[model samples]
Target: MKHERGLLIVLSGPSGVGKGTVRKALFECKDTTLQYSISMTTRSPREGEVNGVDYFFTTKEDFKQRIAENKFLEWAEYVGNYYGTPIEYVEKTLQEGKDILLEIEVQGALQVKKAFPEGIFIFLAPPSLKELQNRIETRGTETEDLIRNRMNAAKEELDMMDAYDYVVENDKVDSACDRVNAIITSEHLKRERVSNYYKRMLEAE
Candidate 1:
């Protein structure tokens, strides 16, 4: 059998666009063995979040220190908090012949693609900006100022959607998950990959 190719699945979306839910569903696929790239954040976990799993909770000072040390793959600031993807985990997983899923913002996704040129980028967009605004407002925990700030930021991020490899519309949870999962599964069976495998096997025979 030929060696399998690894995938770098970089996912991006505006705030409250259902990225997490879509990613969660992808993990449930039978043959899907992609690992999630746990990001480091200075923001505190709300509730029931495990340290080092859900996120690598850290101090602002420590986060800055990581930046100084050049440890982060990609980092970005939002709503007065800093978030970064850990480069080591990404490298290790791909080295092991496993795919990785990175959930980050659009700007950070651009940074990641520059670092790993072969990575696949998928952008999940809401049905509409109005729906995105409703999702934020319906959350009910944020102050008016915070909600307004995020909505404005989402508008800016939406403009960057054209840079992605695949654009998925998150109008419904199940439908959106299916679209994202299909994109990944379809990539695994590309003609060049299959042709390369046959070439290797015939040479060995």
Candidate 2:
């Protein structure tokens, strides 16, 4: 039987909407089987962050060279650093019939949509804009000006929710993970995805 290409699950939303927190929790779950597409970044690694596991750390020159080569599926610059998804690894993984998850920023996610419309896009939204601001404020690492800027960016990002196939509220990490897992399972079961498998089985019979 021919193998089916795996699903590209993109999870994104406003900056402080907890995309990373939820993604980490989801992957830790025993039932989660999606392979995470490690992102490439020009930023220095944080404490306890492994080179390849956390992110593919690289220099600005190397990252820019790849961009010129058009090797990124989606790339974005933020806070004076570059972050991008490599097209090679993602394509190879999907061709092997193993689902891959991409936790990215909204702008990068939109770019991915243009390249792979069949990919599942999930928007992780905050309960409310006010709550989103609170989350950013809670971090306490950003200066007041940066917080204001992030709030402005969040508003614009939230407006793009219509582009996503699903909108999941990040009210609680565990609850959000449940919703994300359920969405993945449901997508796999869609007739359009599994119909060919059933047809092949019938033909074999």
Candidate 3:
């Protein structure tokens, strides 16, 4: 039997939009099957973080070398650190008929869209700009200047929302997860996907 290539689901949003929190919740569900694509970063790992699991931490020199070699499907430098998705791992997993989920920043996601236009792009949005600002302020890890800068950058990111295939507001994590799962399910059941399988089967017969 021929294995069908799996879906590439990209989830992105502005900074401080709880992308990590939402992704963690989504994967914890008993029915979730999407394989999380661990990204590579040039930043220092936080306490208790595991290499090749939370993120594939690497040196800036090595990361730049990989970028020069076109090893990444998409990459972007942010806050003096580089983050990217390794193309080889994603391609191999999809070839094995396993769905891959990429939770990344807006800039990285846009790069992925250009390289993999067929991939499903989901924009995770906050309920409102005020609420987004509140979320950032609530973090308390960033300085006032940094928060202001992030808010400005977020406005720009929100402008790019039209580029995504679907928009799910993060009013509540559970609701957002439900919408994302539903979108993936519908994509799998789309006529375009199923019809290709049926065509190949008939040709084989």
Candidate 1, residues 1-205, lDDT tens digits: the string is: 3336578999999988978778777777787778999989998885677887778999999999999999999999888999899889899888887889998888789999899888889999999999998988887777899998999999999999888899999999889888878897887777765787898779999
Model 1 regions lying over 4 Å from their true place:
1-5
| After superposition, candidate 3 runs with Cα above 4 Å error | 1-3, 46-49, 203-205
Over the stretch 34-109, how does candidate 2's per-residue lDDT look in tens digits?
8999999998885677888879999999999999999999999966789899999999999999999998888899
RMSD score of candidate 1 (Å): 1.6
User: For residue 185, what is the lDDT in candidate 3?
Assistant: 91
Worst 10 residues of 1 by lDDT: 1-10
TM-score of 1: 0.93
lDDT of 1 at 159: 92
The Cα local distance difference test for each model comes to: 0.87, 0.91, 0.91
Prediction 1 global C-alpha lDDT: 0.87
